[model samples]
Target: MPAKKNTADKKISKTVKKDIPQLYSPLLKTYFSDLTSANMIYTKIVRSPITKGRIKSLTLEDIPEGYFLFTAADFGEENYVETLDIQTEILASSEIYYKGQPIALLAGPVFTDLLDLEKNIKMEFEKDPASKIKEKEYPYAQRFIRNGKAQKPEEFTKLFSKKNYDIKGTWTSVLNAPSCNEANGAFCTFDKNILTISTPTQWPKHLQENIKRIFNLKTEEVFIRKTISSGPHTNTIWQNTVIAVMASLVAIKTGKTAQLVLSREEHFEYLIKKSPISIKIRSAVKKDGIIEAVQVLIELDSGYHNPFAAEILDRLVIAANNIYSVRNIEIIAKAYESYTPPVSFNIECIDSQAFFAIENQMQKICNVTGFLPDELRMKNFERKFSLPFTFTNEKVREAFSAIEKMYDVNRKFISYRMESKNRKIDIKNLHNFPLRGIGVACGFNGIGYFGSNIFACNQKMEATLESDGTLEIHALQPSASTLEVWKNTAAQILEIDPKQIKLNSIFDINEDLSVPENVYANVSVMTYLLKKCCQDIQSKRFRKPLPITSTKGFTSAQKKVWNKEKFSGSPFFLSSFGAVVLELEINPYTYKIYIKNVKAVLNAGKIGIPKIAENSVKLSIQHALTELVVDENLHCDQISVSFVQSDNDPTQIDGLISRILPAAFTSALSQATGHEINTIPVKPQHFFKEMISNENSVYSK
Candidate 1:
């Protein structure tokens, strides 16, 4: 990496330089700009129109002279989009599994002529009714169950029959377009068997390996440069690689630079979306509000052909029970391949559904036992921490108390229950007063990768120190904010100013660099490695060698042993506790639910950077709000968020506001409307149908 030039006339004092960080570095500004245009060819991907079918024939007889067409047959070897567990096809060869699947690549000089060529090209397909795909399935033998060792069907029936209250509900979460709307593009050029590509991605090493395998090139023959990215919480890394590989293939074939810019519509159609999930939960609880047993069945649609479906299912299974303690529980998680695009894992999207299911069950217990939502949560709160994944009950109770005190939860919950009862007795009386309700939810978000494998929980970093007292560090793709944290950490260890450090600004890590789900855990791993390097640098400061380098790898102990074959063990590394209280009102006439206010308390271990942690909490809440209630039809009238920092202990909170906010919001909506809401992206139509059904039952009585 070239050092950024100092264009200022006069240099600042060292003391002053330590206080001010260059927020926008020169290298960062130009990372996303189109770098190559001279002698470059534009390319577009031709896709399958049908959802699932077989191609009879494709015609390109009227193609222009300068244009080029490349299909799956053009590649030297078959390419598979790989994961730790499974592999899916990179390009369609014979059968197309889903709509918008890549069929062929077309490249030429003029964009309009390429469009005309696509219009002229025609294909015939034979559509099989059975081939109209529904969903792909993971193996049943890979399921994990706790305290559900009944082998006979009769014993299973007896288990459900002995409970005081048997309740069942299904929760569904649909696709949520991420906030990042910036268009994606890539450019590639080859010279002397060295392929250089520029693109913005979060998974560089994965792409490099894929390119090498596809083109039959060596690792040194391919070079990838970093670019500015909005870092949309989606599968853009894989989608961008598809574009990058396409460009590289064109450039190699034509002996010229190749580039492709996808339109916004194309981005949605081609990229994987957040898979829609359906969760059916059945539980038995005592009249005194104790959870006796629980059984949950979760099904998610992995669109098209994707091998990452198991990762999503594994996370849901881990979070199925949330933070509550139950004696007998059985969780069945299944991923079905559908016609839509495969949904990638975001922190919020992966764990939200399971949290919703568990929280919804708690609300139902309140309905049966005449307890407020907060009261029920407090009753069932786990005071003692579990092994392998330990949580501080003191922190959870403190946060829960703060939310209750800030929002006056207990009094409002009682008042709303009374008002709802009065309105239910006489529907006409509710016209003048909107239905009001308050709900609270508490849970912990697990950090690190989903499973508890020892090998998957390790990270590595390298650091070098120069004779001039400057410290240089090499890390896997770390974000700018993370780099700042690492620099400050090293400065503290070395007893020097942060300006004495030189660090790489790349934002791409190895695609499989297993760490916590959140960014802070990855930073912690880097910090641990840096600490060891600093110790080496300090010991050899004046002894012999001027420039010293140290490389180290850090791995946490496997506190919980997991059996992959049986799919049972402790799957969490560490967990951060959080609670949310949602206060809202509902229009009785229009059936529109308006969120009046939201008070949340997050207890992530310790505070390193309060501002960044606070911003993450706010963003998580905002994203969750949009996903649950603030869509095109529903509206949130008011919202407020507050953070309560834990005691200055060494522990860090895994960012978990996203998982907490949605569950609380949905529970509060159910209380406000006096209707059990099981699905997310709540709409008025669901309530309207419920209202009609209720009225008919009343008329019959």
Candidate 2:
């Protein structure tokens, strides 16, 4: 029997429904059972044990009846992985480049047989003296970027020859791996003429093109079905694509469905790790506390086969003097070859290193000149944007001020500075006293792919109006649903209830509309496209047929003109400004640092849902803090974060938070300990060792 409701109860229910806004989002699921054992066979990769070597011969102890072995010789096509660059080798035919380089693929109906075969496999190699993974001499390259007219070397040397305030510092960041929750895997099946591959990736279009070329198949013959995984950056996309291609190759050869799943250990062993970066900045500041010029030398360890080294250096140059106004600056960045596999991505590699050096230098200058960091930053903050993209001064200042107030940084910095100076004066017994310090860092991140000729600049986004008067968003990729914000944005433009807007997981259109790679940029761009599409649909709904559609590319104003040769131009669509304040307590006995609180302020333009935006920022800050302080065998760590919505500013708020927090955390710990610590994933022993060594040096001096 159906339950009955009174008139008052019905009225109350209607009132509650009207008050709460409705949101429609696709399911956020990363695990999928899309392929079953009946149709799919398990495959495992056999890798070279030596980092660099020439293959002598291969031998197999025993092979099962249904198991198959495939090597580079099996596929005659050039043994290289396809991407923006054609340099990375997929399989070692004659030589191995890295330790975990794939040597062969073994597939079988029973997964146990594949594992048994891998355990019993053996190889012989002639190890090259010059090709050792740890000792290889990587090719080197250098370039300089200057804002003013070009000066001869003699003239450049003369500017720094004066008896001025000279401060020299070196910042080094260790290898920080991307924390991937889901180990990468791929599934492939081939029909009569078409091939279907399922994998978790950011660049499905690139994968499809690479497989098509390798297999000598038509464009339509290859299909890429995306799996669900968030937080894997660019390296994951490339690594997983290689696995997908290998699976497709095996399936085509044996006429059996092939699947390859990288275990967690294999994911770490096989994929690229974040290359270490070292930066040295020498500044020539006038006695009057004005910075006249800066000479910066940056060395990045680009593991062997570093195709993206130039792009990484380009981003570093932009961040070298990011927020300050320095007219005359010389930056020399070099990419050195190393034995590890090449790694490059968004925050995990580039921006974090650049900003840490820049901001740490600012704090060091303040310590020398007796000027507050905030005061010095305000004095030197660049008011107008040049060389790089344009950003309003108010946006930067707003973010800076909000963080300062939220964290009580203004008062704490002064007290901490005085305490640090006193401790340095009598450092004989410094370990007896516990210390607390606060740090602040301000900067902005570019949205979308910028300054790179290899990445797509102009991509399209689609939005449609369904027959039932509902709006549907077709995204290029899947991510955590920020669709509440999108629905509200589209509903406001369409003059309809927010519940009527829906984001679709799949659409009946061609897969050419690959938006910018970053998730935050995708959300911001999709919202803009939805607004434009809603306007078009509203104008047509009265007279035109149902199910209208509209599409748009990034605006001319949003597109950046990049110069590949000279490496100059505005390379980003827009800048998302962020300021982070880290408050920490250092343990005197154990030399451990406890992160007490993390306060951050972001100038992400005009937030739609404040709670959702706040939660998103909190999640990223937590992740960064967990990676920074919590994971390093430390105890009692806590974090808090907030965002300030700027109606006047129009920048998106995606991965900017993750980029800014590491620098702030590092700077804070450096200030507290009175050590110039310039590194990532900072360890307590680094400072503990420094303190013990410095005590002896003080007596000798």
Candidate 3:
């Protein structure tokens, strides 16, 4: 096959500008310029100073009798939110689980009136020492194991004992800072039973359900419209949903439009921040660097109740083995209830621990056996594609090969080590305050819910024939995915030019269409699935078999089958793989790290939109970088929780570098660094410091 021409080398024609409006100005403005109202005011509970306490007596004075107020009591007995049958109570009822738990919510007419009401409210509590889940006393939850028809609390000490090798180290990364924005009040109004609520929410469907249940209204009675979200990564999930529900409750009860806009301080305090996880790993490895057995214990200081703690822990265990052939792996993950708010940090925290353990262990085995890291990894790497496996061996090999070729990883490794040795001997200058050192790390995370999880969307695309023969594509969100699926599908069906098709705005909620928890993994796969379905429907409709405008639901039973031991192989229909090689220059004296450059490659099947796919990979890198470098921490009751601080801002859409098209297979970081990294947001400063402090570090071993 001939070499593909670079996108930059392609010649541009004047007709290209006239043909591609979507490539330029794609955002279509609507009548609703602004969704927020000025009348509503919002404030969160100024939590009690104590951690563990029971509400004894509560009193409120000098407030109008009819002013809207709500607490956990308002949810009633029937209202509940369930993910994979695990029900998570939205509001804290009688007893507060953590110090910053949402006890009650207040919303009303004037901002001053709400503040005055808050000052008058008083509560008395009885301290309970037994209720607190202290870190020092009880670090983990009681574990039960089924042994020959008997269930017993498993001993943690024995389960996690090191048999052949052991390593102890602490890994840390800075949470990217968050940007500050003017506080805007969220308002909802019920006009003729059409309840329209606007807020910054990522999971629109979940928020809609919670609000419907709170107001005791049918699904059609409520409408959730999302505002232009500021943060796309982790900011818009659980916390925002809860606030929107509270505000809607106030509006519905008073028979008038109610608004709840929180101040920036209140947003910071009440909102749940990411939990910092501390991990300890022990492993059994052979002389050849192949892992035999592994034991890991992860401690999550979940501020309050964590809904995704169990799932996150499970993923960490699965990821601990890395992309190696291993047997007899044992993982024990625990979530400790703390006085701080519930923690939902990025997936990188777990990746950091797992990668640190695996990569370090690999290096150790190589050093002991006098083998290169790459050779050891390749020897143990899985090389076959089969079912009933989480990841195919072929896919892994392809990714590694692609990355190695793109970056010339083997040469870089030799160069980096030689440079480090030379720097150590010829350091005479006092002006260079900080010594520069480079480190590398790698990470992988699943996007959608795993196993038997289901997500559905009621997507509708309409097309009208025009006399001028030019097609106009109207879609909910215009991009390559929507264009190919909706407009192109319509064009093919009607036997008209794809440019002549028009798409209408998306505005429908089908109760049948739902997404299971952990929808991120499904983003890329679902796009393809939806597009395929559209093509199938278009082809069938063009044959005069039936109308394409019909509702559809998709469910996969693969995860359940695999979990039950009835099947082996991938539980998902498709999987996306990405690898990154970061060259980090760390200032040893100041503990500061500079990312010299990053080379990343991703494989996600056939590229639908080359530009969009490349952008996604770049965005992922930026997201990981911020989480590793930016510092955002919350200190409460001596324990600290972190947030995505403002400095870790997302990569601007305008300043994107080159978007590389995927080859037959994606590349691996080893090709660039000569060392395999298996962690997310790999902090060079932390890794280098640990390497320097511990002479028996993985790099030296």
Best candidate, TM-score: 2
| TM-score, one value per model | 0.85, 0.87, 0.70
Q: Judge candidate 3 at residue 92 and give its lDDT.
A: 54
Residue range 1-701, candidate 1, lDDT tens digits? 11111111121112222232212121334444367577877888888888777877666765666677776666535456553444556567768777778777778888777888887666777876643346244432234565544445465545666546787888887646454545676778775566777777555656677787777766556667646664444467566777778777788887777777776777655663566678888877777776666788888666664545566677787778776666566778877666666556564337767787788778777776787776666666673433222233456666767876777888887888778777678665656888787777767666445353323555567788878888888655466766777787778877888999997544332334333222323654556567778887778767868788887763444534554565655554445677888887877777776778777677655666777766666666666676675344334445555556655332333346666666677777777777887777777688778766765666677
Writing each residue's lDDT as its tens digit, candidate 3 over 434-547 gives: 333222233344333343222322232233333454443333444455356445444554566766655554445543224322242134443444354455555555455343
Overall local distance difference test of candidate 2: 0.67
Each candidate's clash count: 9, 1, 36
Worst 10 residues of 3 by lDDT: 657-666
Give me the overall lDDT of model 3. 0.46
Q: Each prediction's Cα lDDT score?
A: 0.65, 0.67, 0.46
Model 2, 510-566: lDDT tens per residue?
455342244423666556666677787788888899898887666655554655566
User: Order the candidates by TM-score, highest first — what do you get?
Assistant: 2, 1, 3
Model 1 global lDDT (CA atoms, 0 to 1): 0.65
- Winning model by lDDT: 2
Task: Give the winner by TM-score: 1 or 3.
Answer: 1
